[model samples]
Target: MPQRLFIDVHIVQTVPPANVNRDDQGNPKEAIYGGVRRSRVSSQAWKRATREHFDTTVPEHNRATRTRRLTSELAKRIVHDTKLEREKADRLAGALLTRLNLSQGKKASDTAYLLFYGNAQLDTVAALIAGQAHDLAALDDEKLAEAVKDLPVADAFSTGHPVGVALFGRMVADIPKLNVDASVQVAHALSTHETQLEFDYFTAVDDKTEKEETGAGMIGTIAFNSATLYRYATVGFAQLTDNLGGDTEAALDALDRFVDSFARSAPTGYQNAFAHRTRPSLIAVVVRDDQPVNLVTAFEEPVPSEAGIQATSVRRLAHEYAEASRAWGDSPLHAAATHTFTTDEPRSKETAEALTAAFGDRISFDELRSGLRERLSAVLEAQG
Candidate 1:
């Protein structure tokens, strides 16, 4: 059997008063953990943020699009590649999707649900349609379905998934064969201590109002909270490699991007109001050959804010990691950490030392990225 390898990432970040993720009532999301309510940010919010970050760093060819407008998107490509008009191209695209058992929404331009598809996959499908554009466009819906039933339209989506799709996976409820199992799992981020929501009540004045105007144009209240969060995510190297068709190089690239993206990405909810774009104070990466482990249990007792939560949280996490290592009986293949404290206090220094003692090395963010890539590449090559 191929060796099992997983990369676990843990983060300690502090955000100012901000509603980065909110519930239906427009309040900051929260969850009760360890007998206390902790501020929460859903995994879906973070995943969307991470995927958005990928657009800036990862190559366009390696990215995927998640949208319900798959038909309209595919139709545009068909029209561009063939002489068919936009209307005919749209009908052809819809027919192709219908043959694949992907139903259209109430609007013909939209799919039944959001479909995650690779850029190259859509291009390939468009190329295939362009080959027989006139013939396919001339047939009625029924005849078109019969003519393209076995032309391998669905195969394009079953393989060659872009990096985003491979990491996050795809679910085609209508067709299980098109599903891709995710290689990464992200836990919802939670504050390390108890939190209470706060509200910001303000008024927006109309810019064009006269100087004598006493009233404001709009008034509202926004609910938010500030917390030092403990975030965790893990990526299965073997699964990622398999997802990329056994291409270790591509898997390594994806891993590198994942680390950078997860560490930097922040959900944009109410960002303009709170400007909560703080980078993590601590980031620890562990490469394990056995199984992935999350060290969040460290904060079960809730770190107190009196001694500075960010520094205290870092120390707690390191101690928990050490305890887990001892209990597991087998050390991880590799471990490293990078931290940035806003102040050079004694607690900050102690936290840094603790991390070095537990993780075995303290490096810069750049070093962490390069080191992980090197370690993953060596393991994957050896397994091959």
Candidate 2:
């Protein structure tokens, strides 16, 4: 609540019979909440899917690369930008990375952990090396340490975290100071109804031997479940802007991309077999002048309906949200949208309309994202 601004995204998406997220035993993940087992998909899986979507769809400079080959990746950039030989570039990158204390050994490729770094960060390092490449290449251990003694190795290398890193975060155990605090918090999506795990016993048939062969090429049982899931995430507006080094445009772009990708992206687990690519039946966006309020408890009792689980879940979510808003006082701004629901679903329709009206807008996804960006931009301008 100390932070004066936050964005909360609440969703109701119903996936058909599919294994979007799986446990170690290959069953659909589940959690016991409100004293009943419910189908669950981890926040990690969904975040990864959304990040992957951004990497492909968003601009290259706006995304970060997560990899263990940090040295090699940097060395390639140095070689390309500074025109240094691969071996020299590799050595320079190694020396600079050693300043972070992340190397296991003297080998240029040795790194303590995978790095999630932005392209701009790599360019800064390359520029530094280019400026002092000759001197750094010639210096011995003692003199080399003295020559680069004043470099702001930690903070300097940490600027310009890509949109993904700025929103999600990066941590290096050996260099904790360089870690970027995550501005967004994602909750593990859980079903709004009781979940029962099911298995699909499938057999692969070889094309060469078809009709006459009674034997199967491969046979196995894959576990899965179907559920109407409730997904929630909260973004700290202040932290998000700060994380981008006060670049409001990039911050706004990140917010827009995050909402779009998070809404459309689904985990790829067993997708070839299940093909459960589903859009949310309902989405609620709330911008508050206080801390985030998650509505996962809306389904604490689990909704049952002979007609449709999504319909029941939608009604429950709207009612619970309305009650929560009333209890907590009016939110600064709110919006809701849906991809599916019919006129016949009276309770669902009424609840959705009431909730939308209470939220102050019933806009499409694009409009919702643009409005959020405009609001945040105005806030930034006002603060400035």
Candidate 3:
């Protein structure tokens, strides 16, 4: 029953945050994240990147699966169920999306009708309102689910299956496609590869412009100081596989393409970043231009001061992946890979250096990656 599955890869950026303050309503009145001054990258920007990655990576076997528009479908379903006229339904759907704070996308992202819980719909506030109920949250699971069903919404949401990100070949056990069980796995992939958390910080500041200074942490109070954050995250295939699934050759291929494109296409305003380009192209052949993938790696340039054992392990992983790719027509199953993340910046070693510090010299670099992948895969399988 293993359906041919495809992977869903996403990335989020947390950088160039602005400092500021917020009011009682939770709308940020300020911003603060990084120690110094930063720029603002709306949540829309990050989501746009994610959509771009999906759009560019759909392949021949998965052409039917690539979708960037779910908003319209949602609207259609709502109109049919709510007994509203076409225009009214459409407008209502849009307003609901806004009110619910859903589909917060950037101009660059594609978010027309994407919804979660499979086709599983949430308890419509409209339903609650109609039934003369005060709060929708008070309803139990059955009532909540029943409240949303019998409307125009399709029953095909989730097959009573868990939702999770699929990695490598897709399908969990005999179940084709990563499902509810795969949530942790998907989370693993997302978490390991460029994750981010956003928040606002505000405070008072003294300035020549006749502004007064105050603590940046104050909320609902006026302050001159502010900061905003878009925390960034990135983990290797080992880490992703540890939680989601294996990092199959196909996934790696996509990752390879992602690294190349990302290096060239980071938002110009956010350009000047050498981090994504930490390594040189290791793929023997060039991927066709039509394909798109999201690959972020830490390419560590071999250094003389490095530990000899770890360095060899790094090289060994590359060798194994290269060999498997040719012999088996794919990357080795369950193999771990690593890249030396090198840079001139003060925090260049933060990624690689941090690992060595945490794991100590006992484990080889290759083993480190392998361990992560296997562990993640096992954990996801269990959860599913």
Please list the residue runs of candidate 2 whose C-alpha ends up more than 4 Å from where it truly belongs after superposition: 1-3, 82-85, 103-110, 131-152, 210-213, 342-348, 378-384
Candidate 2 TM-score, true structure as reference: 0.89
Residue 381 CA error for candidate 3 (Å)?
A: 7.2
Which regions of candidate 1 deviate over 4 angstroms? 341-347
Tens-digit lDDT track of model 3 for 1-384: 111222222222222332222245433232232222223334333333433454456542232132334445445565555555555444444433343333444532234333333222322323323332223334554564455444432223222211112221223232233223321121211111121235433454434333454444334321222111212213244323332234344434434443333322332221332122212211111111112222212112221223342333233323433443466464212322233433334443443443233223334333534454454445345545
Winner on lDDT (2 vs 3) = 2
TM-score of each: 0.96, 0.89, 0.28
Residue range 1-384, candidate 2, lDDT tens digits: 124678889899989999988888889999999889999999999999988988888667556888878788878978887787888778777777667777573544856567888877877776776776766867776777776666665665578788888999888777788888898899999999888988999998887885767888999999988989999998887788788887778777888888888888899999999899988888778787767888888899987735578877777777787788788776565454644554457755665565565454456777778887787767767666
Worst 10-residue stretch by lDDT in candidate 3?
184-193
Error of 3 at 187 (Å): 13
Q: For candidate 1, report its TM-score.
A: 0.96
Model 2 residue 365 lDDT?
Answer: 76
Maximum-TM-score candidate: 1
- In terms of lDDT, the poorest run of 10 residues in model 1 is 340-349
lDDT of each: 0.89, 0.80, 0.32
For 1-384, candidate 1 gives per-residue lDDT tens digits of 237999999999999999999999999999999999999999999999999998787667667999999989889899889978999998988877776778678886788899998988998888877778998898988898888777788998888889998899999899999899899999999999999989999999898998888898999999999999999999998788888998888888898999999999999999999999999989999999988898889999998868588889988999999988888796888899888742366657787778878876678999999999888777766877
